[model samples]
Target: MTIDRSSMTALKVTLIGFAALASAMGVGRFAFTPLLPLMQAHAGLSLRQGAWLAGANYIGYLVGAMLCSMRVPATRHAVRYGLVAVALLTLGMGVTGRYDVWLVLRFGAGVASAYVLVGVSAWALPALAGHDRSVWSGWLFAGVGVGISLAGLLVLLAGARGYPPAASWLALGLASTAVAAIAWAPMRAAGASAAASAATQHAGRLSTDDWRLVLCYGTFGFGYIIPATFLPAMARDVIPDPAVFGWVWPVFGATAALSTVAVALGSSRMKSRRVWAIGQLVMAAGVLVPVLWPGIAALLVAAVCVGGTFVAMTVAGLQEARRIAGVNAARLMAAMTAAFALGQLAGPIVVALAATNGTRHAAGPSLLAVALLLAGAWALWRSPD
Candidate 1:
């Protein structure tokens, strides 16, 4: 089927873009959050063990992002295959009891998620920009939050009916596969023209502002990742009931979707750099909220703060790169993603090492360090270049 890009309206394009992201990222990547406590309940995972699993996934993400920046042929087909691979990896998690197997599956899922992310951005953003419908890109980024919320809601319902974490994994995998099928053809065909187009970019000659963006991006990764990874665990420890604390992930997702949409609607008046800076600062405050209060209420607030701003910061930072780098956006985006991946990769490792003392209580000081790093990112983002 020859799909005509010109014939597709903004609404269709937006939904297709959203499905691609929702499938690849929302379920493929984050179905882990709600599954974490369930894994603890059923699979006997400790905090440090869980951090290692998450770390493996982050390392895979860094590799995928780096590969996405390279000029690869038939990338749309690669993305389609990647989505199928993600679905399989997600299902594989349910059948495996071995921790090493779990790590490899999660790592594969991470690679798939990055492919979908970069592929969708490569396909959808430019198409929307061509149509003057760039605002719809918010819906694209918001797909991650939506995926997170949907998976959370699914697990919440499953737990209410006494479903195990394995069931949750299977259900989310099926859900991802279903969505992947719908967008498979569209995603495979949507952005083919740009797949081969790499703008001329000089390596080893980044400007001061470019390095600044990379540093801030990395710090934002470190800042958001800890709370993002462990928030539900903290909630489960405190609440001990899936039905109640399960709501936290959904709330985080809701805040993220709403906030991204709101920011996108106002992007014309607000510069992406400013938006990125504001998001970094707001995320810093969110990271601190749970630390200061340490309860369901504060955790919920932390969810909103982190979920709401992380996507916003992502949109702002990546879009800002496009604004500054023009056709060279792909290279710069890849560099920033590598740095960001490094930051998140370190986040879980930090937690794992901190927990080596055989205490789950190591998150406090580590998170405090993450918050301070976010503060420094905010300062760099605001300081004159």
Candidate 2:
């Protein structure tokens, strides 16, 4: 069956793509953010343990990204099962009692999320291009923010109701399953070929442009993830009120969703590298905010800045990879995703190392170091390769 781009079908597919991501990235990957505090409170989870769990998830993400990049056929099937796996692993967390189980679940969730991300990027992005709806491209990525907002609110509501952390994970998993089901059929119908991930050209040697894009992307990943992983936790230390600190994640997501849409609506004529560079600058400021101000207000400001810029930077970097790599974009996308995952993996370890006397405040210096790394990445972007 042929796809009808002339009708509303294309739009539906686009939104389904968004939902696919929301399920994979939003619920599967990020449900930890709002749930992190709950674990600390009820499960006696330490910050160091949490960092290890997060690191496990990131390592899984890197592995998943690398596997999906191997030019495997039937991406649609892989994604469908991955979505189901995300739903199941998330539900599994609620039922588990051991930290070992939690680590496994987080790692499984990471793998499922990466499969969806890579497969969806392959399927949806090209479809948008074929339909001349490339301007709506960023909306596909906006699912991350939407998922973050929803996960945050879920935790917030559960906290308000005095529900257990396990209950929150269970409820969110149930809801995410429903969303993933909606996305299942569309993606299954679109195969691996739809993604254009396989290279059509062989002049695939990495050019100067490719390396710079990859470097800046790695920085963006390292920079945004610190705040992404710990923003709500940081706020919890300052306010200690779940109700108040909970809003941080939602605000971050709202800003992310809006900024992603804004970037999408802007002219495609804007160069991807420029957007990537500007996003890094804003993200650095966000990472530095709490380091400088050290309060709820500063934390919220950081959330908005970091949330808003991360997804936009992601969109720009991948688009830049595609533009630079041409028909070989899949390999480049895989490379960038791997780099990003490595950066994500590094962030949690850095936080653990920075834990002065095993405290969050002691980690401030390391965060400041993260901000500086982002600044350095900005220089790499403009430097003549």
Candidate 3:
């Protein structure tokens, strides 16, 4: 059977969205995770300093999401230029050793990653639905996992070869450049259809259920970020072996990449909130594992549990928002994202403050995250669909 023009266009949009997300989220926002331990080893970067850097990126993410909520940047511009910005900022990290300079670069990268995510979703989702190819949206989000895994594996290989964090950063930067180039042309051809409609949505009035969804999504963000941010570093503390510890992130990313596809296929049978609640519950159990067991094995389990579910949670949360809000979904989604960003921003800060004398594991904060996640899951399950 021959594929029609709309089908080809939808496929192109999927490819563009995937490449953009991988660059923005994987290399731009999360490359830092795998590189963090290397920085600590080669650059004498302390855990507190790392936490600060993570916080800076999360702050920028919040700012970018807010900007998108306000519809400040055109969709195509955000996707096209945001990919370029992430590449440049990622490259800048390799060239700098100063702590302050690193903070600025990470912050800028966080903004660019958010722009690409929002822009691509807005641009591609409708285009796919119009083509009757909305099933590809799951693959679009899989870019995040693919990017994360690729970046982590690259750092793992580079670090094994005795390369410095700078080298890994530079390599990731170059890879991001290539990924950005793949998405460039298709993004240009994609129409700016979603931005205008999203701008006029009156999302100011939120019912109780809306508030619950926002808070639950925020809780998901806070619950997952601690391990997501520092798992490799934590694993290194147990094994001190890059080969073993390095696998954690790749496993995490691989699980995440597969989980979205699984959910997308199976989601027709279950309500989004139910899927979300179950995922969050599993994440809470995962977060609880390291706290209770305290070893590399537990952290790996945490990685699978958390990573497998975070993206699914994101997909479900957005779906729930759209279901509840209809045309107002854009504003609701923004509110949920801003809440999530705030939750992520708080995760690293809480870790920074809770850890004493450069310790990697903070049991108290982990337990707190577990509690929040469990509570969020319960809220999601109890809320009417």
Q: Which ten-residue region of model 1 has the weakest summed lDDT? A: 195-204
Q: What is the lDDT for 140 in model 3?
A: 79
TM-score to true structure, per model: 0.92, 0.92, 0.94
Residue by residue across 104-171, what tens digits does model 3's lDDT show?
Answer: 99999999988887777655665676677766778878889988999999999988888999998999
User: What Cα-based lDDT does every candidate model obtain?
Assistant: 0.77, 0.77, 0.84
lDDT of 1 by residue, 65-116 (tens): 7776564324465567778888899889878788999999999998887777
Q: Which has the higher TM-score value, candidate number 1 or candidate number 3?
A: 3
Please identify which of the two predictions, 2 or 3, would achieve the higher TM-score against the true structure.
3
Q: What is the lDDT of residue 229 in candidate 1?
A: 81
**lDDT tens digits by residue: candidate 2, 1-385:** 1334543355876787788788888888788977887788788888888888888899889888777655533457657888899999999988987999888999999988888777667556666776778778878888888988988998998876778899998987897788778767766556534533433433356677776666666777788778888888888888877889889999988888888889888746567677777788888888887876788999899999989988888787777776667667766777778778888888888777666533455356446546655664666567552
**Alpha-carbon runs more than 4 Å astray in model 1:** 1-7, 70-75, 196-205, 356-376, 383-385
Best by TM-score: 3
Model 3 misplaced regions, further than 4 Å: 1-8, 192-204, 358-361
Clashes of each: 0, 1, 0
Ten-residue stretch with the least lDDT total in model 2: 194-203
